[model samples]
Target chain A: MEELGPLFVHPYQPDQFWILILIVSLPAIVASLYVLIRGQLPAALSSSLMILLPLVAYLLGDIHLMDESKRVNYCGSCHEAMSPMFETMHNDDSTLAGFHYKRGAISHQTACYSCHSGYGLSGDMTAKLAGMRHMLQTALGSEDYPLRLRRSFDIDSCLDCHAEAKPFRAIEDHRELDIQEALLARDMGCTGECHETAHPEEARHGAAAFAEAR
Target chain B: MARFAALLILVSQLLLLRIVFDTTGPPSTWFTFVGHPLVAAGAVLGIWALTRRLIREAHEHKMAEREDH
Candidate 1:
């Protein structure tokens, strides 16, 4: 499979940016402590060095982390359960995710997030929180795999890109009013019988199969 | 307060570094639950300490002026 470049190619990107922050912060923290203990610097200056800088850095790091959580590798990391989904996305031709990945319809780097994340800021936040929950579950050894979504997939996410496209509208079934309503209401799934699953069958069978094979 | 603030900042920084490098790991979970709160607490304490020191300096300078007079 063709590979995507690293997510953090630029200095401003999260991986590099955080490293830069750590470099500046580590030594500055030491110096700030020394000056603060000696009472050599003004209280305000020492406070800014010790408190304000770290606070700002923390906020910025959080923003970067949120961005990083959107990547496909991030989803694949920290859990064996997610490996098959990544595998299917990469190699399985019949699945929706694979088709998209092979065709360049979605970014390979952020394919999982692109399809799964809901639309708008609130949706983005919800997806990020869900990612955090997954990490927590992994940390606690509480995850039950074949990982399931917290809720049904939102058709609006599909419609956000496909709803108005010429090819999407040209389909006869999609033109039907009730079918459209059912899709909008999520009574019908876009990836149901007609389109099939976004991932392969094994992707839904959890890590047990993968573990058994191993 | 100063020592406590330093400790909190150090811990928070370490947590953040762990999150940055090993993002999808158990340490990231620790960061989400604990590290963020520590940074907030550290900032509050540091500001409070600074305010107290400023007030003390002002009072000491005032007393010195009065004694000279």
Candidate 2:
């Protein structure tokens, strides 16, 4: 398969959009119509079916929504401001996000959500809300240039996936006593000290070039 | 209103599918414009409906009690 491109920048069209629509809509439309045409179901059954059918529809719809959100194109197209970051991810070079994604440490699909998503109760909701804020900021042109994150990336966010992996722990310096302490302390240097950051060299250079050109 | 709000939720979600998954559309569009607004609108409508339902239920109970008296 061709490498996934940014959501909106595809040279060719994909059918996933329609597939999503069909998956979500077909069952719903069918179920609603069935209930409408077959009026006067038993009261108990009517109430149950009314709730159940919509729940089923929601369940299926959400599953497809989750699946589609995993696509790189889906996220990149959502905000033009984020497009540069997507470009950085897609380019080949060993950088923090790019390298891990390319190395398969992160999912090829859902890369954006995987790292950014919160891990505990309401984690997904929190992440999504934060994402919404970013989107809104981007849309309103209120976001700062280069788009600083609210805070530095959390060490826990990295450790969530890496904390258990033998290879992750086995990295040479990461195994050092002080280094381990720092990692636990959520030291910013812990990650960059050994493993690279997610951006590729090309991306870095591209940023530099843009700056120089300016 | 509940029904309308519920429909909005479905509509918004469907619009999001196009925004998120449809690559054939023009590249310049932020499909979220369609999807996100729908979500907000749906939330507002749903809340309005729920409150209305509660008020109606309370009123119905009051009337029923008055009839008994």
Candidate 3:
């Protein structure tokens, strides 16, 4: 028997599941309502069936959509998004992006929303709003926007969930540098080890190489 | 036509999933293929074919009605 992995993981919650269930059942509910209002059983049944097919499709779609690990929503939906960032990743003459993407290292499973978004409502809202703003800017022809990289990667954000499995107790040296100092230096910022590349320069060189090869 | 559209959606979803979930293995084969221009060409052709077929069917149905009149 194939052992299923952990049932509940990050981003998947009881409320979300219930909301999904409601969404999946909406067609049927709407069909029923229509039938009741019109007193037309046969029409209602047909309408219900019509709704049923799409509902199944919706469920399937929801399953795929809800997957936090996929870059479908992140990269595909907003192809123009952080274009420079993706260019840098895929352009690695050394095939760093290709290598990571292939190995699934440079995807939703590891980067973007993972470290940036904290868990629960507050995190989700912040990430989504920020994404919306980015999308708006991208659409409005504001190409000179700054990148999303924080001066210093909030190691605590990474540590929040990962601390239990991989305890990251700050050493004495780690404590020496304050948050402002870390940001200015760009030390301990995101990387392939965290969320792919921390700097645009690294991405550009890597992307140039990757594009040349392909 | 709807079926073809649904299939396209499904395939797109799969590709998106490959982008998102990293299910295509340690070194994502799907990304390489999806990122290729060939896939885009194929998708465009498929959509064009499906749309043309649908329009042809609609035209034929209208012609049949005219003949009946």
Candidate 4:
């Protein structure tokens, strides 16, 4: 009996590289399928030839799964508990997430995570950890529906992009105040009093918003 | 073919999985839930198929030797 290679190993190739691999591997894979399916393999050891097939499909699915986590669309639907919050973002870019994200204030690619995380090495890590907890909560059915912030929204995340911008600094009201002191101290306003809640109480559970999000 | 496809997919996913995981956080448990099963299934099937092929070959070799003797 000939030895067979182990199938499971960590994936480490770059994204663009797959296109090249696929280009080369796909034709052989397809041709091999013709042999495999027609029951007329070139070699009795043809099983070795077909091994790459499942691997490709699995990789594609994995890439998709990864893509889904970062995608606003995917994140919005990850749990029923947070579905409406995501819906609000999708339904009206005019809403807070809409205003900045749809307006490109944050990259649409990093829209939800951009605000949710801070501007440091651990920011993305923090978000991912939080996401894990959310996943667990979702699985356990322990999270409150329409959850509020699990932690205070770090003003730094907002300021990371906005703080130095002339527009934010130049605002007449901001010019008179120590923005960090006020926010970090939790003294008065957050995202300003008028725009306090990102998703309005009504929009949080809007049936239409939720439907369109789907 | 399906098994091969699954193996190819499993390898590809493992190799390129860094794209999704490039971020600094612990991988989402979601990844474990979805990815682990597919990988384990693919690997088990791959091993089983190989084992079956090997056993058949060993039997064939023994029979051929007996005929020659």
Candidate 5:
């Protein structure tokens, strides 16, 4: 059998798994609505109740499974969020992203959730309020904000986990380079000198050829 | 007619909430399930309650007119 990618291989959390079940139950919800519209209140209510009971039960189970320290409620109980920074990280082929998610990097255990959602009650409350504002905007039909990738991209989030790992060495090295002198000498550190582009300009120019094979 | 009106109001409210909570992607599964039904029911109940109040007020107006006559 062919090896599946990390995205497919990893088991989702219990809450996520239950959510999949809820998604599958959408057809039942629709069926109940049909019954209700037909003036069959008893049947409609019964079917709705049947679907609702399991949902409530599953919610309770999820609550129990969630960490008390990081109450799922504080993650804005009503809000839905998947930060764009995370999307960029997922899109990148670098080991930095994969290591953090794939359990290869010990520093980033419970990685994405921990940094974005600060620790303790006060942090949770702050996040909830921010979420509320976002919710309000969405409700008002004012959700057409341009993708402000910069605001979402926080180097600090990476530092929070990897500070001890000396990830800053790369930045320090970059700062040491005299870019002006290098450029004047026609010997840019980036090309034809030291740091070769991971995806070189030549390869980028013929990207279509590579893309077709993929 | 009343129920249908209620249902429409409820749906809009739920959609509003969904738009708020999930700006990046579609509303989370939990939000879709919880918010949709709750808003719908709440809208229906609210409209029904409002209609009842209007009927009561109209009946009182008729009663007052009779007393005056």
Candidate 6:
């Protein structure tokens, strides 16, 4: 497994991070237990213990989970289906993902998510929801082997980071008004006409290479 | 109502704890989909219960003020 690295809270391992979160809510858990045993407590105290503390814990845990879910290791957890993508990221420098990985352009911890997830909170939520769907599909044994993205890749995910960068803007081809308009409108894919795709064409060669890549 | 809210909170917290501990790599489907929503639901119910109490107490306090007036 890849190191979770500085992307996760430091001074503690991943498990320890979660344990710390649990400890934060220990008071609420213990108080809830007490309430369950003794039947009731004073109204204000009860609200503070059962409502306020637990709500805080919920927010913290959920936010942490959301962060954790974006990690490359987390995405690669469905080993059979995702192993090729990982292999490609690690071993093949020809692909866009591998290029980014080799260059240290993206965090190793959040490599997959940096490009796949678009900008802002809406992007994060959309990615998380997609993650849940992937989990469900895997659980149901309904996932197509070597798995395909259900929707077209969002070009905005590319533009969100690269659109303003000097190198990206410096290319004369990139400055062409028609090309710029098409790229922004997503009429031209970032990888479509001129650039190497994020990964080798799995869809083109069929499932054999995908399985073998795993 | 308070007890029920507490129960929801407890159960949801346990579910979250399980997710935290069990999720080494990929999130567990049962925990992520089921547990997350349950936790949100628990928080919602807890806030609603607290708000209900506040509203009831405010109404009673208003009645007491009217009587005094």
Worst 10 residues of 5 chain A by lDDT: A197-206
Model 3 agreement with the true structure over A83-119: per-residue lDDT tens digits: 4455544544345344444445434344556555655
**Model 1 misplacement above 4 A:** A1-16, A19-24, A32-41, B20-22
Which window of ten consecutive residues has the lowest lDDT sum in model 5 chain B? B17-26
Candidate 3 lDDT tens digits, B1-69: 323333433343344334343322211333333322323443454445445656787899999999999
Compose the digit string of candidate 5's lDDT tens values, residues A34-89. 43465323333433432443244334323332332133233233222323333323
Question: What is candidate 1's lDDT per residue for A1-214, written digit by digit as tens?
Answer: 1255665342333456776667656754674466447743456566667777788778767876777778888888765668778777888778888888888788767888988888888888888888878887777778786667667887778888898899999999999999888877778788766788787766766666865654
Model 3 regions more than 4 Å off: A1-42, A50-60, A72-77, A90-109, A132-144, A148-155, A161-171, A176-197, A201-214, B1-69
- Measured by TM-score, how close is model 4 to the native structure? 0.54
Candidate whose TM-score is highest? 1
Model 1 has fnat of 0.51
Q: List, for all models, the DockQ compared with the true complex.
A: 0.53, 0.11, 0.03, 0.13, 0.10, 0.33
What are the per-residue Cα lDDT tens digits for candidate 2 across A43-138? 344333333433444444445554455466666764445555676677753567777677767766678878777576476777757755765665
TM-score of chain A of each: 0.82, 0.60, 0.43, 0.60, 0.35, 0.74
- Pick out the ten consecutive residues of candidate 6 chain A with the lowest summed lDDT: A7-16
Ranking by TM-score: 1, 6, 2, 4, 3, 5
Taking the tens digit of each residue's C-alpha lDDT, what string does model 1 give over B1-69?
666777777778778778767777566677778888998897888777777888889999999999999
How does the DockQ of candidate 3 come out? 0.03
Candidates in descending lDDT order: 1, 6, 4, 2, 3, 5
The model with the greatest DockQ is: 1
Q: Which tens-of-lDDT digit does each residue in A16-38 have in candidate 4? A: 64454355345444644564356
For model 4, residues B4-61, the per-residue Cα lDDT tens digits are 6345334434433533433222233434455556555654565456567668789999
Poorly placed runs, candidate 5 (over 4 Å) = A1-37, A40-111, A128-214, B5-24, B29-69
How accurate locally is residue B56 in candidate 2, as Cα lDDT from 0 to 100?
Answer: 83
Q: Is candidate 2 or candidate 3 better by DockQ?
A: 2
Identify the superior model by DockQ, candidate 3 or candidate 5: 5
